[model samples]
Target: MSETSDAAKAAQSVEAEYASAEQPPALDTDAEDVGLMAVPATAAGLPATAQGHFAVVNANGTLARGFGVVSSSRLALGQYQVIFIQPVTRSAYTATIGLTGSVGASPPGEIAVVGRAGNANGVFVQTWNSAGAPADRAFHLHVSS
Candidate 1:
């Protein structure tokens, strides 16, 4: 038992098992259900829970949910309307509206429905054959479920 005192008692039992090791639990940002969950404004149809920009598809087999709105200002053409904080629960019938970013002219296909079907929010835009009647736009409206 004297090989340098048995290697100093096996290095003090491996430093007491690395000082009793046992740590991993330090992240409790005040814990009380921590964040984002209050979706209720008449929650209905395919993932409708009252937020914004949503999509939950699986069509042919059922289960669909897609709601949206992305907007920009400045228009001078015939129609250009908007609205939709969160309102697209039932009848949207594959709704869609387009035109995006830096588009100055000649970019406004069409989409003029989804105004109140089962409580939609709003929509309407123009331009397609109107060529480039009035510019400055960026719109994207969507609906499903």
Candidate 2:
């Protein structure tokens, strides 16, 4: 009879493979820039004054997925801006600590949102750890006019 691989043997094989592996790429947790993000053409037609739009932002200020969102940028530690295709000045904003991908629970943190200075179609977002220091966090943002 043929025998299946044992768990210990499989683990040893994996460890052997890892011994020759190169260093993994750096994580994006605190990346200064993720470069220019590609926005879908559909986002352009979205009215700047549209309501009920939302964005899922990654820890590095990249847009995971969003409706009526054009782009995102990391301005400073724990400070980011979400740019919309339409104006959000008359809209109410809400943000929550969350993940950009399917990864489980997010780290506990505080989030705040406000209108971007000198920009009507932008919203500034800030994140902080439980200790109230600047922190990188994934989040979801919603806007309702």
Candidate 3:
């Protein structure tokens, strides 16, 4: 067959398989703005951590996008576009939990959190030790609730 005809046949085959598939792949939650996307747990389970090229601010109790951890002591990053989607209430507090990367590609890294803005008026962005450690650690946090 001609190249064009061959390619058309392959495309049709792919489409047929997709149409008959049970479900699509679950999207990576860590890559979306907080309010714009709501990612439920997949077969792998809910995103236990956010791991991406972007920094994510997971609201308290909400899973961090893009990254997750096999254990609390370590984390892996993912890719997500993060933003402050909603504002907290007067009686509520906003917490910023940050997970830092390892030194020279090592595991068993460190994490830091900063809580500030009077429980309802703070914004945060994640940082790393290369940014400068606050108290001799790889990460630091300032929180006020």
> lDDT winner among the candidates?
2
Ranking by TM-score: 2, 1, 3
Which portions of model 3 miss their true places by more than 4 Å? 28-145
Candidate 3 shows a clash count of: 21
**How are the candidates ranked when ordered by lDDT, highest leading?**
2, 1, 3
CA displacement after TM-score superposition, residue 64 of candidate 2 (Å): 0.6
* TM-score for each predicted model, relative to the true structure: 0.23, 0.65, 0.20
Error of model 3, residue 18, in angstroms: 1.0
Candidate 2: residue pairs that collide: 48-86, 48-87
Error of 2 at 114 (Å): 0.4
- The model with the greater lDDT, 2 or 3, is 2
- The alpha-carbon deviation from the true structure for residue 108 of candidate 2, after best TM-score superposition, in angstroms, is 0.6
The lDDT of each candidate is 0.42, 0.88, 0.35
**Poorest 10 consecutive residues by lDDT, candidate 2:** 32-41
lDDT of 1 by residue, 54-96 (tens): 3321211111333464332223443444444555444353333
